[model samples]
Target chain A: MAEQVTRKPYVREVPRMLWFLRHPRYMRYMAREFSCLFIGAYTLMLVVGLKRLAEGPDAWAGFLAALGSPGAIVFHLFALAFSAYHSITWFRLTPKAMPVQIGDTFVADRVISGAHYAGWALVSLVVLWLAGAF
Target chain B: MATSNKPIVWGPFAAGGTLTAFLTPVLILLTLLAGLGHAPDLLAYDALRAFAAHGIVKLGLVVVIFLSLWSAAHRLRITCYDLGLRADTLVATLVYAVAIAGTVAAAAYLLRLNPV
Candidate 1:
């Protein structure tokens, strides 16, 4: 039988919702995590756009027209900024997540992250070209 | 210890994070351009419609949307935990449900956009 100790251990409780506000680094981490909300909402907008497209030309046009609203434009701008932040953080973390080994030595962090940047640039160019942006 | 299904969710999270890393910023930029009424010609209603009607484009769209939504859902689940919302089961269920629903809706809509 285990003895029941009468001692109460000291506990320091962190504030529930605002703990991340305690440090600038923590705030940055929270911002990175919070970007997911904007990304998720933006993805949902695409789903809605798909739905409107499926409905026909009038619905699709209306959807586009709605997107041109000031509020929608502002939302898109925020989403853009957040998603870009997500990309930067993701790329910065990738070398840690995936380390390539060649022979006896591992690849440099910059090499791996540089490759991601290169790929991102290539992908952006391809998408822009496909979207008819020269 | 019993096996955990963590990898199943994690696989998509990593893949989607990578995909979104490379692609999402540009996609959002295009949306911003559209919202600002400067969308390129190919993004026009007819052009985009024809593009979506293609089989490959439909598949690509479904994959992108599904993975992005799933990744965001999983990320938000972790974020909620960090924010001291310790009811993980409830949060996971809610977020995963939304991701799954978004994926199904996207697939359904794309399916309706048959070649014309």
Candidate 2:
């Protein structure tokens, strides 16, 4: 029989709500991470719209009309704001995730972030142009 | 197993996160503004449908949707873990399944478009 060793381990039980409030960084991280939920919702909406488009004109038009509702408008507004937060925070984090080296010197974080913004603008313009909305 | 490889999911999650970083805001703004009936001439249903009829455009849409959804799923899985949902494997599986399902549905629909 193996001898039993008795030991008590101390465990910390943290209250899940307001867990980030104790630290500013945790709060920001949580805010940025949670914004993905809004992004996901918007993506799901686009998928539905795409399916409706495939279903032909009436379904597509119905989706458009549904988007005009007060509730949808409100949700969309919130989604837009959250997505902005998500984009900005993610852009800020990109440099840390994938650092760019220019020659022997490391690229500045701001430069990397700036390039991301520039690319974003150019892509947005292209998408707009392709859709003939520009 | 706690030692299970996470990089498989992480790679897509990171890529998806990056993709959404660039595109989500633009999509939301355009969609909501169009929703409010301010859709520009180029964005009218027929025009947008026409745009989707291209193979390259359809492929691009699939890539964007897949990455964004997968990233969101990864985020949700982390959120669940943080919230004390101790069953990491189950939560991860469930969330990832949702992302996969959404991506498959989106791809199927995009493929069904009239590639003009």
Candidate 3:
């Protein structure tokens, strides 16, 4: 009888990877998460302002002073960039989150995003007016 | 391995739901305290501080903070996975572990702060 040849189990050097990030679904998800960075930072900024409010008048003034500093101004500009990205992505997602159908007629996603942009524009005008910047 | 058609459920929702169920009452209590609008007169400090001092309140906050953080971390991991970022099981586990730990530390620090 011929000797039976031993067979070794095959092991892949690189494991079978799930390519989720490359998927379009993942690209959208990542964009949303990146937007949260702005939201988190904005929240912290407000919290710091609130803490200063609780501290006293001097602290509050100091907080306002810090906000006007060159570093703070740069951070605010960066925050604005993130905020814009966040706003666009968030509004774009609104249609998915709350689909609107009027008697079997589905509303367009562009309509939703456009409505949000209009609303923000109105809000900005109102805020600028209130701040006497207009 | 064959994949199932059923949607994969995460653990944080189950844990967070249980935690939130218990925390809701405390949140209501805190809301009521804050609503009173005389925290200084009633508690000599901020309403949040007053609420933190109570045993049940503290426990409720701890539960809320940790569970919420865990839930956020789990969601963040899923988001990262969806984005085609690092989606290894080890990384996901580490993300949640760190989030839970950070939340616990934050709760502890908040509890230790003396109300003024």
Candidate 4:
């Protein structure tokens, strides 16, 4: 451990919002991380749906009606696009954060990332099938 | 040095991140479909209610909702910190509280959903 000094030390502050602007990767990472807000918002909306359902059909119907509004539709469109970006970046990053090893050989990052997309497709298909969207 | 119990929250945050990555886009599209009035018959009020009325489905919803909420909470907290919010304790409490409350509300509502 270094000895503590009584002399004043120089310090520099990073511009919080624009800090990531310095690097393309940081910018992309920030954008990816920022997608969580939209995800959270959508989840809250789902919770609202659940609440409406629990309140009975009239409430649920009202919720559905609200969902049909132009504003809601537009928001959903943007949120969907933004969320897709978030999802893609997230999948790419997943392999880095959570790595896999098999029989003394580490799996390739792209393969792990591909697995994320594959799983997403699989789950979405099941959900769509069960929901009778097909 | 003071100890920080961030690891506790980080665990769920990480799990939630993974779950959110997989489900968020699908959910967004589904919501859009519903909003556009092209919702499948199975997703209509009566059918959707019946689908959600299953105990297993409700259980899964609870888990997904809980994890996703926590994940979002932790993410937002970090974002806030990065964005120059110096109140770590306050931000953590508020964001995490929202996540926890949302999870509790989801579980409660899910439990109230009667089986058809």
**Per-candidate TM-score, first chain only?**
0.90, 0.81, 0.71, 0.79
Better of 1 and 2 by TM-score: 1
Winning model by TM-score: 1
- What's the true lDDT of residue A132 in model 1? 76
Best by DockQ: 1
State the local distance difference test value for candidate 2: 0.84
Model 1 lDDT per residue over A1-134, tens place: 59988899999988999999999999999989988999999999999999999999999889889989999988888888888889988988898998999999999999998888889989999998889766
Ranking by TM-score: 1, 4, 2, 3
Error of 3 at B53 (Å): 24
RMSD (CA, Å), each prediction: 2.1, 3.3, 11.4, 3.6
Weakest ten-residue segment in model 2 chain B by summed lDDT = B39-48
Candidate 1 local lDDT, B27-86, one digit each (tens): 888877877888877778889889999999889999999899999999999999998899
Among all windows of 10 consecutive residues in model 2 chain A, the one with the lowest summed lDDT is A125-134
Error of 1 at B71 (Å): 0.3
DockQ of 1: 0.84
Give one digit per residue, the lDDT tens place, for model 3 in B1-116: 98862233355544643333223223322222323332223223344345455667556545656654555456556666554566558767776676656565655555564445
The regions of model 4 sitting more than 4 angstroms off are: A1-13, B1-4
DockQ of each: 0.84, 0.64, 0.06, 0.69
lDDT agreement with native, every candidate: 0.91, 0.84, 0.52, 0.84
DockQ score for candidate 3: 0.06
lDDT of 1 at A57: 91
RMSD of 4: 3.6
Candidate 4 per-residue lDDT, tens place, B5-88, comes to: 878998898888878777877777777787788886766888888888998989989888988889988888898887788799
